[model samples]
Target chain A: METQLFVQIALNGWNQQVARAEKFFNGLSDEAFQRTVGAGKNRIIYLYGHLTAYHDMLKETLGLGTATHSFLVNDFLKNADDVKANMPSVAELRQYWAEVHNELNVLFAALPAEDWFKRHNAMTDEDFKKDPTRNRLSVLLSRTNHIAYHFGQLVLA
Target chain B: METQLFVQIALNGWNQQVARAEKFFNGLSDEAFQRTVGAGKNRIIYLYGHLTAYHDMLKETLGLGTATHSFLVNDFLKNADDVKANMPSVAELRQYWAEVHNELNVLFAALPAEDWFKRHNAMTDEDFKKDPTRNRLSVLLSRTNHIAYHFGQLVLA
Candidate 1:
């Protein structure tokens, strides 16, 4: 498919699923969010924080600045207790998520169709070669897809 | 993620999306299903045939018995009219897809878990290894994911 087609399809999928997660967590109590689930693999809190962190990294990597921080990496660097203690309040988390979601939507909506095929370096220094038919748009869609995939995991957990 | 978790998560995502696609296509009209969404890409009819063929190949590659014919490969060899002029009716396509899906699920369920990690020779005589915890499952999931990824294209078209 062409660059435009890929980005539109990806955005449609990402918007639907991420909105679902946002609403589900919006009504949850802080204590409930922190309660371990799935044999401690992920709690609701960790899932939210991880999603925020991951998207933020992708945004920054793609040259779109993000306000969210990477708690998963931070937890690894510091301690689990510190990560837990730094958890955003439910309202704060909700606002941050909405901001990120809307910010991303704005970014996607405003993207120049031509830039969709422009080559750029990924965070890993992987050189993404450019081809007009399906290039940078595919890469951006790939990042959004990362969000959609993890959103499914959050839903199941 | 560890190899085991990575493989399992990948498998879970693959199966979940396939189930969604199967359910969606089950409700589509025969004409709609056979509509030439494109060439060298999935239409609903071509996808069913392609996925079944790949699963059969996977079984054979794993030294499991043949469960289905590789229709697309043979058709290409014979220069048959592509799905363009020769698409199956929706019912036939659905039946073929269901049969292949069932066979794949059963075959996977029956495999010894250890086989996922066993090393084997590639058809090209290259050294190949299967890590249930990593390699085999990743490849298996990719088989479906590659389909799902393209299927999204079919739907969008």
Candidate 2:
């Protein structure tokens, strides 16, 4: 397949997962978001926030822009869900989720086909040179799966 | 990136998920497999068998080989888990999981890079002509996410 087509396929997969997540979280009730995946697992709210924070970081990770929601890093990314930790309300998280993905969609579309194969900010130049498979497209693919993984947990709520 | 590199990345993602599922399931106690993801959702055994059955179908879906575990289709694929339905023992499902993925790993590695871009058995020639993105590699990518989705549920067990 052509390189452009390959890039499109990867992007399409990412977009599909993004859409699924958006729809699922949008429909969830505020109370439902408080429920854990199991008796003692991450709550739906935390997963939603964690996903949003991760997507926000993708801006810098992909070298397209800066992370707009860095404030969510400590609560949603670095630490697991804590009842005591200050968290955004479900309404605020919903807004942040939409904002992060909306901005990402634009940045992702503007990325040239060849640029998807280039190294992202997370990889060292020498490391990327030695292992070119760890490119922007691969990161997108991994993140796509990441969303699906968490969405699985969300479904149990 | 080169086409070979693209194929490698997709396959690597698939393999990584497979390894994770293997490790997670193997370490789980037989009793744990009986637990559901939530209070009334799919039990871990059902998800294990469901994933195994899906991978078995991939053999034919990729046009590489025939399914070796067609017996699992009706219970694990065509229908949801039923308390009254006859099911495989946890040990049996574990064995099937290993067999299906082990065989697939061999078939997948033997496939040429260019072949990954070709249409799979599930797609029509006309549809594939209009949309080449629905190729074998795309199926693998989707299935990779599928496993990750289920793995998320499995983790809650």
Candidate 3:
């Protein structure tokens, strides 16, 4: 597959990584996820929500995409583990995980090949015209990096 | 750029993530890295070498490239923290990190655009002919996920 077809190949790889990361999460002990991990004070659950929130936010930024976990944005984004008392249940977070991926998968599969090059959500025609790099492909590339970064964290957890 | 030239765009993003990960590594305190991270028995140093060695091995697997850290493959690959006594010093592993990345950057830049779709190192010409999916693009995609997965692990350190 060349460029356009490369989209599906890339998307498949991303979905696999998400599955791989969730597997790591599933293997973790409850206490382990609740405690601070590595150098950061954030617990494993915080990172989980952090990742979910990122995908949810991406839904808005990428344009033409729907978010599955808008409710997570406030408590999880940049909150880290500080608000432990208010954090969502692990069951709810796990549900958000599946919902986010499912939503993205359906939404993405429906987008025609040309749409991958179009500008996402909030950017205006003039803004996109000025900065052509902020297209759908660029967002896809960034999200892959984002998920991989978190996947690495999950490995440690 | 479309699919073929999309190589460079993807490469640029991978490089930026590597830079971002290295920045995180550079910021860690000595004690923090030595401590057990999260629920895993492995330490930060092992994860560091794990990532570097993966790229090093990928260098050979994807073909037309040489591994920079051959010494590390036996020790770091699949060994995990079990062989900590035999593991390379943190300083030495850090050196391998830079060496492996430098080696890959030079090697990849030299490849022609079409080389990306060519067969990888070990796959038989006949086999690859049957399964064209195992081309240079797939290798590139896998390595990107690998690095991102490991990069996430480093964030915890």
Q: Give i-RMS (Å) per prediction.
A: 17.2, 0.8, 2.8
Query: Where's the lowest-lDDT run of ten residues in candidate 2 chain B?
Result: B32-41
A54 in model 1: Cα distance from truth in Å?
7.3
lDDT of 1 by residue, A1-157 (tens): 2234333434554565567667778767777776543333456676676666666565666665554556545642234423346666756666666776777778767876545445443523344322222244444444444545444344334
Task: Place model 2 in a CAPRI quality band.
Answer: high
| Candidate 3 or 1, higher DockQ | 3
Which candidate should be chosen as best, given TM-score against the real structure? Answer: 2
Return the candidate ranking by DockQ, descending.
2, 3, 1
Write down the worst ten-residue block by lDDT for model 2 chain A: A1-10
Q: What global local distance difference test value does model 2 have?
A: 0.91
Question: Roughly what TM-score does model 3 have, to 2 decimal places?
Answer: 0.82
**Which residue pairs of candidate 1 clash?**
B116-B132, B117-B132
- Residue pairs with clashing backbones, model 2: none
The model with the greatest DockQ is 2
Over the stretch B39-107, how does candidate 3's per-residue lDDT look in tens digits?
Answer: 556677777777788888888888867776778877678665764467787778778889888888888
Ranking by TM-score: 2, 3, 1
How many pairs of residues collide in model 3? Answer: 8
Winner on lDDT between 1 and 3 is 3
Model 2: residues with Cα > 4 Å off, grouped in runs = none
